[model samples]
Target: MDTPALIADDLVVLRGGRKTVDGASLTVAPGEIYALLGGNGAGKSTTLFAILGLIKRSSGVIQVAGHDPEVAPDAVRAAAAYLPENVALYDHLSALENIRYFLGLAGQTRTGAELDQAFDAVKLAPAARTRRVSGFSKGMRQKTAIALALLRQTPVLLLDEPTSGLDPAAARDFHDLLIDLRKRRVATLMVTHDLFGAADTADRIGVLQGGRIAQEWTAAAQGPRFDIQALHQSYAGPDAA
Candidate 1:
């Protein structure tokens, strides 16, 4: 065992007087990329929120980097970087300025050149480096978010809908970035609707249905062939075998 980098044991969450997460348990070791799948309202996002301490979990223990978020929120957040579906940034600020601001908030200051270098890592265009974010596309914004996380150099990452709404080329680049992150030993947990992405990047894919893990699969070693359509069918059908 590599000593789990993230753990959620019997975690539960309630919303609108209903059970959303019912005794969910999960663990992720270092250097592993886990793809979390589920139907609508299956608690996938809830689980991530619980682990991040974004929402108050109703019950169970959640740990990241050996620290409970409730007991040590700063430490837990420091050990992990999260990228939501939409990154909140000042639309008028340049990419470099955005990086400096977040890094400074975390007490890590960056020079202009250093900030540009970080954006370059995610293949941001030089012109965009100094341009306002209001003009940047969704892909550019997502890249900026990733670059910020990369700057933090956290051990764990939780991504929700990372590739959603991106074009084919942009999505492919995003996938490549994630693969590179895995090589750098970042423990990853992604909740995505893109099954192809899961097959391409994840060492393991876990399906969460009705609040419980329904199945687990390994990627094919020789090729990029994953039957996501079939898996989706199986996932949607109540009679899946």
Candidate 2:
């Protein structure tokens, strides 16, 4: 088997003495799109945060792009880009400005032409390129964030609730964008509540319930039998219940 691009072993998190993520363990290989699915309060966000070094893992080992965040944050972060459900962009900054700014933070220095191409690749509207994000819609903001990620050219992507509050049309577009990223061989970890999105986009799915993955759904044939319903029910294993 190919070596995993990301790995988590005995991932644990605590908030007010509650074990939110209890002993979650998994490995994600290169070019694989993995979805972390669960209902609210299931610790999906917590897991992503821990992996990104946003919230320290109380007692777990997580390797992102062959680097340990606890021991080497800069190296791990350099290989990954994070897009949370609610991206925090400067409302006063134009999309291009936002992309340019964050790219700099990632130690990236792209020329204007390169930056523009990144925006176009993510399908951000050229018409909205110069407009401040203050008035842009959620979808527009997300596209800007994606542009930043693309420009950074990270190997691993970590997203939390990526499709929340998006209209069907916008959400569909987002799904397509993710598919395109996979074609480019970027390993993706999507924390999503949208089961339909999970069924369509992810190569594999894991349900995070009770602090452990109840079961794993490996890649199925590409026909209509991706088994969306089976995945839904599989989340509720005897242990999960």
Candidate 3:
């Protein structure tokens, strides 16, 4: 069997001598979209940071593209494309220019036509490609960031609250972009508060509580079905009843 694109087995992270991420385990297979659902302080972002090797893992294993993040941080980074909540871009640069500049920083050089295609793949308007990102809407900016991810063509993708501020239509567009990535076999792990979006986009969903995955659901198992109410209840916790 092919190795999973991302995996965290019994992962733990300590902050101030306390375990913020406690024995959380999950996997994202190639072409899979896994949503890690949680409220604030649930250790969602910490787990992602650990996978990126941004923080020292107090214990357990983390692999990005089959390489340990701690032992081979460079390999893990090369294999993953991360889109944080607020994607940072040069305000003065046009969409095309931004992608070109960042790609060059990663030691990649692509022609103008190829860059245009990447923007197109992410559904960015051709007209907007020449406009400075400083004036772009949140959705437009996100598409630009995703366009860069397309150029990178990494095997693993990490997203944090990717749809936080978008309206319904833009959120839908973002979800569609992720589906396209899935077709290309990019394993995606997203931390989100968007329950409906998670149900709609993820092949599997894991609910995190107190830094551990307390519940998991698979679309295939649900099959043409999803109960947002149940998901909300799970998210609401035992006291919500």
Which candidate has the highest TM-score of all? 3
**Reference-based TM-score, model 1:** 0.92
Worst 10 residues of 3 by lDDT: 220-229
Model 1: residues with Cα > 4 Å off, grouped in runs: 111-114, 220-230, 238-241
For model 2, residues 111-152, the per-residue Cα lDDT tens digits are 889888878877787889999999988988888898888888
The prediction achieving the highest lDDT against the true structure is 3
lDDT of 1: 0.85
Model 3, span 115-218: residue lDDT tens:
88888787889999999999999999999999999999899999999999999998998999899999999999999999989889898999988879999988
> What lDDT tens digits, residue by residue, belong to model 1 across residues 114-228?
6676677788988887789999899999999998998888999999989989999888989888888888888899998887778777887878876767787766777764676
> What is the model-wide C-alpha lDDT for candidate 3?
0.91
Candidate 3: where is the Cα deviation over 4 Å?
A: 221-225, 238-241
TM-scores for all candidates: the values are 0.92, 0.93, 0.96
* lDDT score at residue 231, model 3, on the 0-100 scale: 79
